[model samples]
Target: MVNLFSHNISNSNAINNIYNIIYDYASLISGVLSIIGCSLNLFLLYILIRDKQFHTVSYKLIRISVISDILSSFTIGTGCLLISYEFTYDGGIILCRVVIFFTFTSNGVSILNLCLIAIDRYFAIVKPFYRRYHRRRKQIFYLSQIFVWTIS
Candidate 1:
């Protein structure tokens, strides 16, 4: 692998090789994750959209989570793909920053979306009094999508 290549090179070359290797690994992982995430998201979306009875607060949150996951997957995956395809980053400084920013923001949004789902479930199960609070979960789900976009 690149590690073996690095060991045969001089110090500076080794450093550069290490960077390339890390970048390739990141891209590979991101691509794989995105493929899986997108597949599952599509499936979940199909199920939700097809079943009228499944349109509940819980399903609303699930849809939101899947959307977030899909976005996260694509942003991260595309950045990684670009890095792997153009090892020297042909996109230049602005794109590099943009890609990195999106990667981080999507990851953060995905995590926060999951956190929100957990909170919603907790309220649904443990705080029965507040279950009614989530009667507007679908609207809040849309609002959360907007919020995530604004923050990101």
Candidate 2:
């Protein structure tokens, strides 16, 4: 859709599209991506919640990651929707701080989730003996997740 509204009007590759509504390309793209991302995450969350096969410690972490993704998507989507609708909401300092905090926290949680998964995979692959000897209980992973959330 953004491509359809060519910035370079004189360019040969531009398509002559006719429309009454003018859209902000950035907002539209962000909103579209947010919807798509939220949908995919919701689907994956559903599968994880419903399927017995996905009920494992590792999958629990994945589920948490998916949740964070959903949260971040919603945050972005909310802003985009407001902008697209031309809402004159210039939220002051407190609102801005809260929004920024949540965004960064969710993003940090996701990165930490990946880091946990990577470390687990690395241990399993590189030092099987070490991992076998230091086999942690499910409580450890659960605690780690809690820690990750709190720290994030």
Candidate 3:
């Protein structure tokens, strides 16, 4: 009975080892992809900010979205990769809370920015009159972004 029990334990350990190996590989692949994606986002953001001609309301919204995407990629994507590698949050509750907060906030900002962009486009194409008013009140766009960040 003891020998049988030992054999079963060894099999379980082997299975767990295999699982860990697979998880590590997956985490590595995901981490690399996330880094690449964030790099592209940063490049786009740099181009947008550097080009004075693209300094319009729509581009501003796009910039915000890209910033949030980069944030999300760094925060949430890193968190997931760490988790896959069985990294413990030895830093205590505060660190976990901060990570969670930033991940959620960044995702929220990205979604809100997309919604704002869609609304702006709708106004521009569907109601030209409203679009003119929107252009005149550029402060509204800025305020909306502020509101989104605050809420997030």
Candidate 4:
């Protein structure tokens, strides 16, 4: 019969090798995508700044989403790269927690901002009058933006 302890050790070594391969490839891919995402976000920000017409509530939400997407892309690459180094190293677990928290939190914020944009579009369409007095609801819009960032 095969020795159980030796079998377990061999299996664990195989798993560790697989993890290293996956982590290295994942980090490489994530780094490339992060660079692309950050560049796109910067371009969008430039347009948001230069264009006067795209400063409405929905567009503002989209801007926020783009910003958070940039943050998320950065954090995702960071987390992947960190994991590419064995996570058991000194202080690695805490670093991972911090990196992963920001990654997920920014992603959550981006998604929530998209949802807010959808809601704004719905109101603009279903309640056509809602578009007429955006200035009156400006404070509410800002508050909702704050709430979205906060909750996420």
Candidate 5:
């Protein structure tokens, strides 16, 4: 009975150790990637904002997408990093709710932006006349963005 109990305890400890290692590595990789992603997105946003030539509907959509990406990276990515470091927020339930809200909203916005891009491409390629019409209606893109935010 003593040997059995000792063996079970050792096995449980080993399993826990393995789990910790995996979680640590996963969190580290996710945090690093998120930082890289946010950096690249910010660079792209800067270029878009600096260049007047990029002030088109598509570019606007891209800018919105990048903004959402940055938000996600900052909120979710930072949370993951904190967890990996065994740090707790202790900022109460409101902070937790805010984090969750921003993370999900940003993710939703990102997805919606992609859908807008795809629709724009479809009109450009599959319906060239409609694409020309779209070019004159820049408000459409802005409206779509607003709609996305509203939904998110």
Candidate 6:
């Protein structure tokens, strides 16, 4: 019987219908975004890996960012699609936790890499002498990339 005292409505047809509509729209948006992100990431990876000259440290950092974004999109975007299609919490707790962790970690890493890139640029422009006197820009960039990945 319906929980009349608790004021919980027994007929949830309206709520369920609204949810279905929203989920479909969200799935469409997520799918489109995932495709775009994956395509851009693959293109970047191809440009960086195929051309030896593009192996400069700066490009390497960008490559890492692209990889992380691709992974993030795959996990989070696909999860959203599944949820939309199933319309149920079928992923369970473990899968849900793992997906969430990867999503958060990858997003954080992507942002951190961008921040490091900015810092590297500032150093390059502000202190040109330091680049020459100390480690080469290429080496410094590689080291910073490694540092960001390791920390992330």
Using TM-score, give the best candidate's number: 3
In the range 91-142, model 2's lDDT, one tens digit per residue, is: 5344456656778999999999988877766766787688442567466687
TM-score of each: 0.62, 0.71, 0.83, 0.77, 0.77, 0.73
Instruction: For residues 1-152, write the lDDT of model 6, one tens digit per residue.
Output: 45773455534766888888987898778877887787888887898899999775556778888889888878776766666665445555655787688788788788888887787767768876774725766676667767776777
User: What's model 3's TM-score?
Assistant: 0.83
Between 2 and 4, whose lDDT is larger?
Answer: 4
lDDT of each: 0.73, 0.77, 0.82, 0.79, 0.83, 0.75
Over 1-152, each residue of candidate 3 has an lDDT whose tens digit, in order, gives 99999999999999999998988788778777888888999999999999998798888999998998898777756765665655556743555676689878988998899898888888788887875666665877978989999998
lDDT of 1 at 68: 67
TM-score-sorted candidate list, best first: 3, 5, 4, 6, 2, 1
- Residues 1-152 of candidate 1 have per-residue lDDT tens digits of 99977767778787899998997888788778777777888888899878999786666667766676776667666766666776554565665787677667766777667766787788878986764566776677678767866776
lDDT, residue 40, model 5: 88
All predictions: root-mean-square deviation over Cα? 6.2, 8.2, 2.7, 3.2, 3.3, 3.8
Judging by lDDT against the true structure, name the best candidate: 5
Model 6 residue-pair collision total:
0
CA error at residue 73 for candidate 1, angstroms: 0.9
Model 1, global lDDT: 0.73
Q: What lDDT tens digits, residue by residue, belong to model 4 across residues 72-108?
A: 7777666666666656766776877787788878888
Cα shift from native, residue 122, model 4 (Å): 2.1
Kindly report the root-mean-square deviation of model 2 from the true structure over all alpha carbons.
8.2
- Candidate 1 displacement at residue 3 in angstroms: 25
